[model samples]
Target: MSLDLTCPYCQQPFQLAGEQPGKHANCPHCGKQFPIPASEVRLSRKVDQEPVPQRIAPATFWYVQTEDGRQFGPVTEGQLQAWYEEGRITANCQLLRKGADQWQWATDLYPDLHQIGEKKPQGAAAAKPPPPKQALDRPALPQSAAPITPLSPDDFPTTGAGLKSLGPVLRPLPPGYGEPRLHSFEALEDRRKFAPFMVAHMNRPPLNKMLLVLGIANFVVGTLRAVLYFALFLGLLGAIGAVDERGDERVANRAAVSLGIAFVMFVLNIFVISGGVGLLQRKEWGRSATFAGTLIGMIIQLTCVCVTMMLGADGSGLASAIWIVLLVLLLPSILYDAFAAATLTLPSVVTDLEE
Candidate 1:
């Protein structure tokens, strides 16, 4: 590199090859020899003044030397220039100088800048600019005198620096912002049961879309099944009543009476099915109607089971037992739906109270 025709020591304009990094160069005018920044001789430093409010940007970077435990600014050009003018370079301050090949740091170069005047400007002391935000942080900012702009993802460094390039810049998220939210839904299974329960059960009012749908479907199906099954049973009973069997009158009467009783039972089953469906659907009318029907169905089934065991044939007894088993099977779903429907009803009840 070419140098101005002046001596660095005396400001003489004489020119020479720029001093090799470590060589000591002398000026003909002043005979002063200053060591060039290199391995052999280094300019040690001391901080002449503490950081001033105007001198330091709200945010700046500093380099620390591990060997000597001194901090210096290499990238902060303005701050470094100020320190240089202040003659703060000492034997203890950290220095990070870039060489032809690689960057080297030294701690015995200057004093800490903290010794400078510690006073800061009054009223509107410089405030640091806010940092970037992450996903898990605040969803939005609150309304305030000065609105804050949200940070973008691009503000953060995605890759770390390496031997070939500068290290990654890691800017901390600002206060009031939260951590990044998890991107994957892999953990959703763990929360499935609890999430639904809370939405369905705990919130003063229920707001579950799935539960509501299920309740309604149950009511519709139950009503339809009740209509069909009771219709079939009654039709069979009517046919029996119309029969004129030549057999013993006692036999005919018994058969006709049993058929009548079964028809009656069928009529009741319709009500039970209707009620169960209604409760599942979470309709207020359905919930109540089903609850009543289920209880009655249970009673009638148990009674038929007893009657069959005492008077009917073994097949009849088994059929009655099977019917009882079915009734038992339906009991839990009916009860749960009743409770759920009732739970849903509570909100309306509360609203009524408020009104």
Candidate 2:
């Protein structure tokens, strides 16, 4: 082994060249020769070792916490995450970024939350962490659900720690089961306040599903109506051909009028179909077009019903009443238009489309 020795001439340290016992060696520092002791202790080994360097934690720009309106630090992502896991900071602690105006939750800022614990603390030897988190002797299930009382906004915990602790206990559930969503609370509140037996029809998000159904339905209905209108137009044209205006001006004029109506309807249906396609693509214009078409359809259908009843009723009160009643109950086209209008007007649907 090479010997780590002090050069007696210069009092400087240097390693000897060879592994064998030597009598004389040159001091690289002073450039002077020195005697190597024959039976001195070997002060060096094959491998040279040095103390590992202490790693410094890197930090980012400053952030302000919302809870106490106090700035946390110019801290690394890992350190912030560690504070969160330690419950020194809660999810409700909204942080305003260095150059930003609005504040966002820590979870929103840091997605790699649970993994931060795996990293060694920066300067772990010098820093003193908070009291070691302890396990409760009592069961964790009940505590997981902090609020056990009936659903009431008044009774709800408004504090961060309280709210953080409030949630359905994590069960050893099978697949497709997990933490109860926050929306479920809204359902519970409604049920308790309204009808106990009424179950929430929609627990999942409605935007995508409704958009798909209504968009496709609009497309299909518009196409079918267009085909019907075109067929009627063709039939009218044949009538006009069979009975020339010269032969029967009245019949030909009526046929011409019906054909024009059919043509206009077909053109409108094309717009409706385009609107439906737009809706499927989640365009604002599609929602607007579909909504406008729905309103026009409702108006036209109602007008037709009124006009037909007045011109054809002939004072048959019973028949006219029955007709109006049936139309009100079973006018699928107008009713569907109204329904579509309602869905499109919903704030959730509108907001989703904007997004």
Which candidate has the highest lDDT of all? 2
| TM-score, every prediction | 0.29, 0.37
Hey, what RMSD does candidate 1 come out at? 21.0
Which stretches of model 2 miss by more than 4 angstroms? Answer: 1-206, 313-330
lDDT of each: 0.45, 0.61
Question: Considering only N, C-alpha and C atoms within 3 Å, which residue pairs clash in candidate 2?
Answer: none
- Which tens-of-lDDT digit does each residue in 1-355 have in candidate 2? 5777788878999887675466778888789987887554344442445455866434344343534444445443444445544455543455543344445565465443322213333444345333212211221121122321222333222344323321222223445556866768877788767863333223423558788888999999889888978897888888899888369876677568668867876776777798899888777889988888877777776776676667665543236676676466437877887898899888767665631
Q: Candidate 1: where is the Cα deviation over 4 Å?
A: 1-204, 207-235, 238-243, 312-355
Over 1-355, each residue of candidate 1 has an lDDT whose tens digit, in order, gives 4333445566775444643665666776788876554532222121223454554224333332322332333333334333333344332233444222223322122222222222222223133212221112222232234332322345322244542322332334445667778845656655655586553444444434544553565456556646655675676566555555444565456556656655665565565556545544444565555545545555554565566556646445336666566556455535544554454455443231110
lDDT of 1: 0.45
Residue 6 CA error for candidate 1 (Å)? 67
lDDT value for model 2:
0.61
